[model samples]
Target: MAMSDVLDEGPFFHGTIADLRVGDFLAPGYRSNYRPEVVMNHIYFTALVDGAGLAAEIAAELAGGDAIPRVYAVEPTGPFENDPNVTDKKFPGNPTRSYRSSAPLKIVGEVKDWTRLTPEALEMWRERLATLQSDRRAEIIN
Candidate 1:
């Protein structure tokens, strides 16, 4: 089968707000975003590609793929706890709270911002994969 043919095999996945977790994710560029019925904690995401040439293949076929979104996760970097330290003692209204990651996060976001990846983005996929592999270890029990 042609390399392009392999890319066409079906059974794509989808994500929704209910699947949101406090971690990093890499999602395929599909329109059915995991947006939930109701807004909740925000999630961070990255896009994955094999290499520059392979990336081009994915891009070119994007218009024809299943269009089903995909999501993979990794450990989150910030304190995910809800702390009373600075929370308003008296939230007269909804009392709902929200927290966000530190600003000036990274360059991957630039894709969404620019609708394309710059050469600098070349390393992002490799870096994210490495980060995800950090916890893979042989178990040792006594």
Candidate 2:
């Protein structure tokens, strides 16, 4: 499947069912109840842009992880705060972008298993991240 088929905009979100559902995509904000270690608005979604990485993330957050994790096909409606693609820890927590959806995000579907990413998928993900990073840099430069 094409990355555009699964992704609506710049990138998709890889997170637990509860967090995604609870977080308001319409007015995306920080989670008050997140783990103490996590910053107030440092929401870490995936830049994986594929099922394999998404499923792995979902399983990691859940107990047992027997059931499939939900994948949120979200668009980066606003400017992203952190750079998950960046190796440097600009912030104390995991590198993630804090985004507010410009439009309503849709629940694309669930990843049933830890699917393996095809070579094409991996390449697409890398390219997409590069584009996003470049866009962010442009935004800063402007």
| Per-residue C-alpha lDDT of model 2 across residues 38-111, encoded as one tens digit per residue | 22433344555443254333344333345434555444443443333232334444334333222344445444
RMSD list, candidates in order: 19.3, 11.7
Which sections of candidate 1 miss by over 4 Å?
A: 1-115, 136-142
TM-scores for all predictions? 0.18, 0.37
Q: Which candidate is the best by lDDT?
A: 2
Superpose all Cα atoms of candidate 2 onto the true structure and report the RMSD in Å to 1 decimal. Answer: 11.7
lDDT of 1 by residue, 29-108 (tens): 32311121223233322222222223332333333344322232233243222112222433432122211222212222
CA lDDT of each prediction against the hidden true structure: 0.27, 0.41
Native-to-model Cα distance after best TM-score fit, residue 25 in candidate 2, in Å? 1.7
